[model samples]
Target: MTIRVLIVDDSKTMQAVLRARLSREADIEVVATAGNAAEARQLMRELDPDVVTLDIEMPGMNGLDFLEKIMRLRPTPVIVVSSAAQAGTESAARALALGAVDCYAKADRFGAMGTEDNGKLASLIRQAAQIRFDQRAPSIPKVSVKTQKSIGGDTRLIAIGSSTGGVEALQILLRDFPADCPPTMIVQHINVNFAAAVARRLDSICKAKVLLAEPDMPIRRGQVYFAPGGDRHMMLGGTENWFVKLRQGDLVSGHRPSVDALFRSIAPKIRGHVVGVLMTGMGSDGARGLLEMAQAGATTIAQNEASCTVFGMPRAAIELGAAGVVAPLDRIAEHALSRAA
Candidate 1:
């Protein structure tokens, strides 16, 4: 099926470049091009495109403001396409929080749009087109932290894997965690460039200290270690004295910093002392490893379909008997903590 797309950017040159790139993809068609939020809104009312490519730095109503409006009213799938996203800036992370389905790093104003990323952007467009949005509140209300407490002795570590809709999911999940939560490890599939910004964004919101994992960094209570994106897979090291270890490797289950690698690594060493959570994502990256964790007697949880933006990862785990429990997104934090407690 053809995926109709709307291009919204202040620059005519960027519009042309995006149009040209998308034109090469037979299944993708640029239905409309708008220079600013006003024109974009008008086209949205008329075309109802399957996907939108939005530039954050637009005139008048900014891309973020317009994106919030779209999500609140029409609820359409939107991809933030901007140099701001490419730079792994705070604006890019904010776009995701505001309900953008994905972010595509585009060439800067003075830079040339490279040929290598054409097909990649097309792939993202195809994926975004398949998403269905509902007219609901754009943000999840932060959970009250007063009820939370420190982790139980049985739960030595908390490891989480997510992709696609993970940013928002993690935000909601972590907010409910106590200030002195267990040593938490997270692998959220993302653009390598955007990893730091995402970590920073999460740190600002959560009670626990959220940090990007560094090689050989010791696991500690009250901290959440986020895997660094790129060519290395983040794994657990030192059985009794656990630390984050980044290993250079080819893609495992189609991701470099794979969820499977992280889950599998922790399974044997920690055994029943771990709590594994596989949240909203596309594809089955964490299924097998989650099974391994379950087999090792670790408490394993999967996010249920009702709350997942895309239920692919969790569904795969559920089918494989990997998940010890399947829970809705809202209840996951409480449930996981209960298991740990």
Candidate 2:
């Protein structure tokens, strides 16, 4: 099937560059282009594209506002394109929180561009086109309070891993957490530019205090730790009273702050004191690590297929017999809280 895409950017050069790069893919077709949000909205209706390549810094109706509108009205997958800089990162991350499906950071103007970068963009667009868009307010099944599982001990820690549709998925899951929830740590595959913004955004909405994890930062209850975006891996470490540590290393599971890295790091120390929750993502990064958690007697919960934006990671864990329980997005928080409490 042809993946029709609409390009929205104020800069004619970038728009042409994006269109040219994307057109190299056999299945992708650039149907239309727009210079701003108003033009983009009109083209979206006229072209009815499968996906959108959005620029965050457009004049008159910025990408973030436009993204929210698209999600509410049309609901197609959107890939945000921004510069590989700190300012660009904040806008892109905000776009994700507002419902963008993916983000791509461009190389600096003088930096040499490569085929691999273009290839990754095409791959993300294709994967997004294949996915069925998951809305925020779907028909929720009636949750039975009696169905809640009782975990035995005081929940010492919680670890979560996600990617792709994670921004919304994590928000949905974390909104249910109590103010005094367990010391939670998360590894969500996001661009380094927007990692801190994402944590701050979540901190504003969530009951728990969410902050980007710093090297040697001690972990404690009621505060949620987030892995920063970059070439470094965020892992759980420290012997007595755990702390988050960042390591510079080769990518694991195709990501620096990989779900696998987080899970593998926490595996040795969990020992029934932690709850591991692997949510919606497009890869098998956290599968093996979740198995380690389960083997270590920690309660492991995988988001069920019915409620997943993409079931790859959760399905991987379930197939590996790593998940102790499978729950929908809505019930995951409840289950995790029950297990932890």
Q: Write the per-residue lDDT of candidate 1 for residues 151-267, one digit (tens) a residue.
A: 465678989999887887888888887778889999998877678888999998888999999999999999999998889999999978999999999999999899999999988
Cα distance off (Å), candidate 1, residue 223: 0.5
lDDT, residue 185, model 2? 91
Clashing pairs in 2: 192-229
Best by lDDT: 1
Worst 10 residues of 2 by lDDT: 139-148
Give a tens-digit lDDT track for model 2, residues 61-117: 988888988887888889998887766777776788776878887664556554346
Candidate 1 regions with alpha-carbon error over 4 angstroms:
84-88, 108-111, 115-118, 135-150
Please provide TM-scores, in order, for all candidate models, with all chains considered together: 0.94, 0.89
Q: How far is candidate 2 from the true structure (C-alpha RMSD, Å)?
A: 3.3
* TM-score of model 1 vs. true structure: 0.94
Off by over 4 Å in 2: 109-118, 134-153
